[model samples]
Target: MSNPGSYPLPDRFDAVLAEQDAEGYRCRFAPVALSDLPDRDVLVEVRYSSLNYKDALAVTGRGKIIRQSPMVLGIDLAGRVVSSGSSRFRPGDAVVVTGQGLSETEWGGYSPWQRVRAESLIPLPPAFSLAQAMGIGTAGVTAMLSVMALERYGLAPTPRPMVVTGAGGGVGSMAVALLARLGYPVAAVTGRAALHDYLTQLGARQVLDRSALAQASPALGNERWAGGIDSVGGKTLAYLLAHTAAHGAVAACGLAGGADLPVTVFPFILRSVGLLGISSSSTPAAAQTQVWRRLARDLPASVVDSISRVEPLSRIFELAEEILAGGVRGRIILDVRA
Candidate 1:
C-alpha cells in the first residue's frame, strides 16, 4: 500500500497503439479503463518506458509480436510502485519489469500504468535512476548476459579482441560500449559507415563493414574474434561462427537478419568454437537477478547519452516503423507521462 502523495494511482491514461491501417501502421491513442487491466500482484505508475525491435515488429505487422490486438505495445518500463499485493514490494518501491510476455501475450508498459507479476519485478538498482534503467532496458540486459556468458565459458580472454556485430543497433551498440569500457579491444561491425565515429567514441578500437564478416563458408576460413556479441542472426551469425578464433564463442540474441542459422559445423567440431544462445526473454529467475546487477555496476553511466533517444509515448508508432527499416540507432526511451 502507498500513501496518496507518494504513490498515488493514475486515475486515467491514454494507451498508445499501432493500429492496422490500409496503408500500414498508424499511430493512435485509445482510452483505457484501469479496471480492464489484467490481475497482477503489482500496479506500477510507469514513469518511463522504451522501444525495442520487437515493438516495431508488433506495430508494423511485419511480425506478430502481440498475441492480442488493440494491445498496449511497449516492452520495457521502470517506475515507482503505486500498489502492491505482494510482500516483496510496497507502495513507493522503485522497480523494473522486463520480458514476461511484455508486448506479446499480455498488457505491457506503454501506458501511464502497468500491472505486473511481483516475481517479474526487480528493485531498481541504487546506482541508476528509473530513466537510466529504461535507457538500458532489455537491450542492456541482453548485452550483459552475452558478455557474462563469454566470460563464464572461457571464450573471453584478456588481450584478445572482442567483436560486436550490428554495432549500430541497440543490443550491439550496448555490447560494444560495455566491452570497450571493460578494457577489451573491440571490433565493431555495422552497415552504416556514418556510425564509425559513434562506435569508436563508445570505445570500439576498430569498426568493420558488415560485409567484412560476410557469411560463413563450409568448414572454416579465418582464425579471428576472441569471442563475439552478435545481435544479427542468420548469415551474420554464421560468419561469426566460421571465423571465430580457436575455442572462441559467439553469444547470439536477435534474429534481425533471419532466424535461419545456416552454418557448417566445422567451427564447432574442429576449432572448438561455441555458439551460445542468449534468450533474455525467458532467462531463469536467478540468472535475471545476476545480470541486472552487472548492468548497474559494470556498465558505465556515460553509455546512456551515447546510446539513447528519448521520445514521448505519443510518437512510438512512427518510431516503430523507422526502427524496423534499420534506420534507428541505439535505444529509444519513452516518457510515459510526458
Candidate 2:
C-alpha cells in the first residue's frame, strides 16, 4: 500500500456544499480548502460517497436533514486514511463512514477529502473494495440493521414473504437483496412499474405495485407478510403492519412516502405485531461495523453493481433533483475524484 506521504495533496478540493440563503438552501460545487475541514482524529482522502434519501433531502432542501448551514452534503463515504490522531487507524488504512451526524452537525463526505472522528470510521472489510463499500453505503447498512433487528425480534426465513416497500429506492433495494440472499422470500413494492424486472433481478420473488399498499388500510387486515422492511412510511407502513403475521416484525426506516401512520393499535394489541424503528445515523460504531461485516458476507457484489451506478460529484445537484423526484432507481455512488 502507498503511504499517505507518497501522494501530493491538494490545497483545495471540490465539494458539494449546501448553504442557507434568503430563499432557503442552495447547493453547489465549491472549492473548499483543506484547512477548513473540522479538526478531527482522522483525515480521509475520500474516494467515494453514496447518495441516499437523506442526501437528496439535504441537497434539494426538500427536508431538514442538515442542522447547520454551509454543510457538505453526503451521508456515506469510503476512502483511505491520510492521517490519524487515534491508534485505532493508521495512514493508508481503508475506512468507511456512514452517518454519525455527517452532513448534519458535522462536515461530511461530499468533499474529496474530509476530517472525520476516528470513532466514526469503520475499517473497510477485506470482502469489499472502497468503491463497493460506498455502493452498499448507508442504504446497505440500514438494510442489514433492519434484518438484524427483525431476527432479534424472532423473525426468520419462512414460506411467507417479507415485503420491502419503495423497492426501487436505495434502502428498499438493499433490503430486498439482503433478505433474498438470506433465504427469505421477498415481495418488492414500488410505484414504478418499470422497476419490476429490476427488482426481480435483485432477487425479489414478487414485485408488488406500491399503490396496492399506499391506501389507508384497515386497523387489522388479513395477515399477509411474515414481516417487512418499510422505507416508505405513512399508509404503506400502516398497510404492512395491518397485514403482518402474528409475532412478526416490520422495520421502519424512512419517510419517503409521508410521516404520519394513520392506523390504530389493533395490529399491535390484537396480533402482537412488532414495529422496529431503524435509525442508522445514530448507530454505535461497533454495531455499524457488525452490520457492514454482515453486508460484505451476505450481499453479492453483482447485486451491489446492479443496484448502483457511479456518477461524478460535479453532477450532484442534478442527481439530487432526480433522486428527490423518485427518478433514481437505486443507489448513486459519487466518485469524488472524478
Candidate 3:
C-alpha cells in the first residue's frame, strides 16, 4: 500500500451528505473527516463530479436514491488516487468512478476526498482530462450504453431519424449528440421550449415539444421514428414503443416522467418493436470500459464543453432544485475541489 503521508492529504474535506433525522431527511454540505470514509482500497482526491438526475433526486429528497443514510450524494466522479492498496492503482493515478451503487448503497462522489473500492475505478482514458471525464460522467455512460444496446439489437443510422426524450437533460443531451455524430438524424424532445436552440446546438436535427409524445399514447401509432433513446418513461416511452418502425428498438434508461407503462403489447406483437432496459448503475466492468472507449472516440470534448458548465459543489442544493424543476439545459459539472 502506498503511504498516505506521501500525499498532501487533508485531515477533513467538504462533501454533500444526505441523512435522515428525527425531523426529516436533509442534505447539506458538511466537513467530513478522512477517517469517516469507508475503508476501501483506494483513497481518491475527487477533482470533479457531475450532477445527474439521480443525484438531484437524492439531494432534493424527491426520489429514494439514498438507501443508506449519511451517504455522499454524487453518482459520478473523476479524480486522482492519493493512496491505493491494490497493485492496479498507485498514488497519483487518474481515475473515474460512476454508478456501482454510488449515492445509494455506497458512498459517492460529492466529496473532495473519498475512499472507493479499487474495482469501482476506471483509469481515466487518455482522450479526456479529469474534468472532461466528469463532463461525460454517468449520464454519458448511460447514453452510450443505450446506443450500444440499440446497435446490438441491429438498429443503425438511417434517414428514419432517432428520437431522444428528456433531450434537455444530461443523458438525453448526450444521446442527441452521440446519435447525430454517428450519422443518424436526431429528434430531441424537451418539455421546455426555451431549450430548442440549445438542443439543436448539441446536434439535434429537430427539436420537438414534450407534449408531442407525453400524451396518452395508443397501443400502436404511426411509425414516426426508426428507433430512440428514451430517458423519460411512462407516456414518452409508450409513445416511442407505439410509433417505432418495425424491428426498431427503444433503449429505456430512466423514469423521469413516470414509471408506469400505459400501453399494451401491440407494438411488440405487430411491429416487433424491442424495448431494451438500460441499468447503468450495475453495468459490468467490461461493458463500462467499452462505453468509455466509445464515448472517448465518439463524443468530442468541444461538444461536451458546449453542453456542460462548471459550478462549485456548494451550490448543489440550488442546482438540484433547478434540475428537478426542468430548468437546467445540459450537464452541470461540480468542481469538488472548489
Candidate 4:
C-alpha cells in the first residue's frame, strides 16, 4: 500500500471529466493538471473511487446530476491526504470523501488526485481499507443512515422482517446486509432473479420479486414488514408505506423507480407509520461521523466485501451505462492508481 505523501506526486493525472454545451455533453478519460483543481483546503491522493447511480447520470449525461461541467464524475472516494491547509487534517491521514455536492457543484473523486473541502472529509475507520471505504462509498453511507433512522426511531430488530427495495443495487444491497447483520430479518426485493443468490449471500432472509411490490397497494394493506428501507421510490415506496407495521418507520432514500408517490395518506393516518427522508448528500459532518462510526461497528467486513467488486478506471464508461440501465449488481469501485 502507498503511504500518504510517499508516492512521487504527479503534477498531472488521469480523470473522467464531464463537459456540456448547447450541442450536448461529453465525458472522457484525460489527464488533468493538479493546479487546475478547484481551490480547496485539502489535497488528497485518491486511491479508490466508486461508481454510484448519481455518478452514472453525471458521466452519461442522462440526468442533471452535474450542476457544472468540466468537473470530475465520482461521488465518493477514499485516499490519503497529501497536503492540507486546514488544521483539521494532515498529511498521511487516511480519509474518505462523499456527498457535500461532490461531482455536482464541485470537483469530485474520479481521479488519482483531487482537491476537497476540509469539512467534507472524514477519517476512514481504522477497520476498513481504502478499497473497503470506497466500496461503501455514498451508497453504503446512505444505507447506514437509513438503518440509523430506523434504530433511532425505536424500531429495533425483531422477528418481523424489514423490507429493502431495490436490493440488487448498491444502496439496497448494503442496506440488506447491514440490517441482517444487526439481527433484523431482511426481505430484499429485486427485479433481477439472477441476483437471488447474490442477495442471499449479503444476508437477506428472503428475496421478493420487484413486481410483487410494484403494484399499487390498497390505502391500508395488511401490515407485512415491521420497517422498511426504500431505495426504489414510487410504487415500491407506496407498497412499503401501506404494509408497514403500526408505528414503524420507513426511511426513503433514492428515486430509482420514479418520484411521484401515487398513494393516499391512509398509511400514515391509519397505521401511525412514519416516513423518514434520507439525504446522504448535504449531510452535516457531525451526522456523517456518527453514521460512519455505526457502520464501522455494525457492518461486518465480510458483508461489505461480499457486496462490492472492483473495476479499473478504464471500464468506468461502460459501467456507467450498465448502472443507469439497472443492469449492474452490487457496488463498483474504481482503482484510480495508474
Candidate 5:
C-alpha cells in the first residue's frame, strides 16, 4: 500500500520506539502512519538505518542517551528524500543523516518515515548504495577519521605494529580493516580470544589480550606499537601510550572500558609520543568530506559485507540488551523498512 502523502509503504511501516516502563525499560513500535510523523523541513522515507553503541544504550534506557520520551531509536539513517522544504534537496535525492542528536534529543530514523532538519542532511557519497552508506554509518566515518589522524601524524609502513584496542567492536573493526587495507600491520587488542580469528579476517595480523596490558605499568613499556587507534579508552589508552614506539601517534576514541586513565607522563615526556584526539562532533565539513571520499576509494568492497550484521527495527530492543552485555559482534545495520 502507498503511504497517504509520501513514499510507498507496505501493509505496515516498521519503526522502533522507546518508552519508559514503570518497572524499568521498554521499546516497541506499532504500525505508525506517515501522517502521524512530527513536522520538519525534510520528510525522509528512511529505507535503511544502522546502530552504534549509543543507539544500543538509547534503546535500553541504561544510559541517558535519549533525552525525550516515546522516541524513535536510530542514530544513522540512509534514505531517499521523499519530500523537502529546503532548496538544497528535492524529492528522490539520496542522503545520509547522522549524529545530529537523533534517537537522543529528537525522534530518529527507526521509523520508515522521519522529518529531519534539512541543514543536517548530507548527500550520499557517489560510490555507495544507500544501504552500503548506512552499513558504513557513523562507526565507519569515525574509524576513517581515526585512521586519517594517524596518517596525518606520519603512521607509515613500519615493522612495529599499529595496535587497535576494542578491535572486535564497530569502530575498532573498521579501523583494523581500513589500516590493514592501507598496508599497515594491525594488532587487535581484545579479551575475547575467540574473536582472534574474526579480527584476523578483518585485517589484524595479530591479536593481543586486554589483560596483558593491565599488569604492566606505563611510564614506558615495551616499545611495541608504531602507532595505535585506541577505542576502549581508560587503562587501554594508558597502555597504548606506554607502548607506542618513539614518536608514534594514537587516535583516542570511545570509553568502552572506562574513562579513568591512571598514567604517568613518561610515554610523552621521554618518547615524544603523540596522542591525537579524533572527535566526530566538531570535525569540519571539508575534512569530513575528505575522509568520506577516502573511505569510498580505499575501504575494500568485501569489508562492507564482512563487518556488518543485518537486523529489523523491531529487534533493536533485544539488540540493545546484547550490546550492553558486550555480546554483539561487528556492525549491526537496521532495516527500517522491514
Candidate 6:
C-alpha cells in the first residue's frame, strides 16, 4: 500500500453518511469534511470494512443501532494509521478497529477516513491483508471470543461432536471452521438445506437440519453433543442447554432467532451443564489482543478465504437487506476504495 499522505490531501472525502430525523434514519454517499469525524486520538485512512448484520440494521433503520444523528454506519474497519496522538500507534502502521461503540457513539468505517480512540485499534496481524482482516470482522472476532470462552470452560475436541447452531451465518460458520480446524468433530445446524454441502466443506462432520434438532431434542433427552456454540437464542439455545452432555458447556453469542429462552433448569441442576455468554463489543483491549493472536494461530488462510467474499461499498445497501433477511452467507468484506 502506498503512503496515503503522498496524494494531495483533500479537506473532504466520500462517506456513507447517516442521519436520524422526524422522517426516520437515512443514509447515502456524501462528501464529509475531515473536521466532521469524531474527536479522537487516532486518524485512520480506512482501506476496507465489512457489512455486518448490526451495520445493515444501522444503515437501513431496521434496528436502533445508531443513537446519535449523522453517524457513520460501519462496525469494522481495517487500514493504515494516518496519524496518532497516542504513543500506541504511528503513521503507516496497519491497524483494525471494530465494535467499541462504532456506528453508535463514534463515527465508524463507512468513510475514506475515521477518527477513533487509539484504545479501540488492534494492530493488524502481518499475515493478513487489510481486506482479510475485515473478512474476519466483528462476527469472526465474536466467534473467536466464544471459542475462547468455551475453552476457558474446558470444552475440547473429543469423541462426541460439538454442535454449532445458525451454522450458515458469519459467527456460526466461523465457529464451525475454528472448532473443526482444532480437530473437533462439528455438527452444524441450519434451516437451509442448500447449505449442508457448504457447511460440510467448511469442516462440519455432520449437517443437521434445524427442524431435526427440535424433533430429536427433549427436556433432558439424549445428551448428544459434548458442547456447542449457539447464535440462535430462543428455543434453539434452550434445546442446546437441554441436550448437552452432563458437565458440558454451551457458549451463547447472538440472539438471531429470538431473545426469549423458554427453558427449564433441568440442564443446570440435573446435568451440571454450563452456559457461557459471549459479548465481544466491550471486551478490554488486552483480551481483544489475546483473541486476535489466537485467531491468527487458529483460523487458517484456506478457511478465511473460503468463508469471505469481497464487494464494493456501493453494494452495501442491497447486501444489508439480504443479510437482514438471512439470504447471505459467511462474511462480506467491503472494499472502501472501490
Best by lDDT: 2
Q: Which candidate, 2 or 6, would have the higher lDDT against the true structure? A: 2
What would the per-residue lDDT of candidate 4 be over residues 1-338, giving only the tens digit for each residue?
Answer: 23366568777878999888896678898889988999998989899999999999888888888888788888898999988989999888999987888888989898888999999899999989999998898999999999988887899988899999999999999999999889999999999999999989888989999998899888888889999999999988998998999999899999999998888898888888999999999797678988889989988777788888989988988988999899888898899874
Report, for every candidate in turn, its global Cα lDDT versus the true structure: 0.82, 0.91, 0.89, 0.89, 0.81, 0.87
Candidate 6 Cα lDDT to native: 0.87
| Reference-based lDDT, residue 115, model 4 | 90
Q: For each candidate, what TM-score against the reference?
A: 0.93, 0.97, 0.96, 0.97, 0.90, 0.96
lDDT of 2: 0.91
Candidate 5 ranges beyond 4 A from true positions = 1-14, 19-26, 30-36, 282-286
Ten contiguous residues with the weakest lDDT in model 3: 1-10
Please state the error at residue 113 of candidate 1 in Å. 0.5
Evaluate residue 37 in candidate 3 and report its C-alpha lDDT on the 0 to 100 scale: 97
Q: Considering TM-score, which of the candidate structures 2 and 5 is the better prediction for this target?
A: 2
Q: Write the per-residue lDDT of candidate 1 for residues 1-338, one digit (tens) a residue.
A: 46433334555668876565466555467778878678988888888998889877876677767666557777788988888899998888888877777877767888888888888888888878888888898898899999999888885446768889989999988999889877889999999999999999999999999986666555587777788999888888888888888888999998878898889788999989988989887875467788888887877666776699788877777888888888898988888876
Angstrom error at residue 83, model 4: 0.7
Query: Which segments of model 6 are wrong by more than 4 Å?
Result: 1-8, 214-217
Candidate 2 contains a number of clashing pairs equal to: 0
**Candidate 3 residue lDDT tens string, 1-338:** 34443346778877899899886569988889989999898988888999998898899888888897889899999988888889999988899998988899889999988899888889888988888888889999999999999999999998998999999999999999999999999999988888878888888889998887889988888998999999989988999999999999999999989999898989999999999999999996667988999998999988988888999988888988998887887799999876
lDDT of 6 by residue, 162-250 (tens): 99998999998999999999988999999899998889999999999887655434678688999999988888888898889988989
**Residue 6, model 2: Cα distance from true site in angstroms:** 7.8
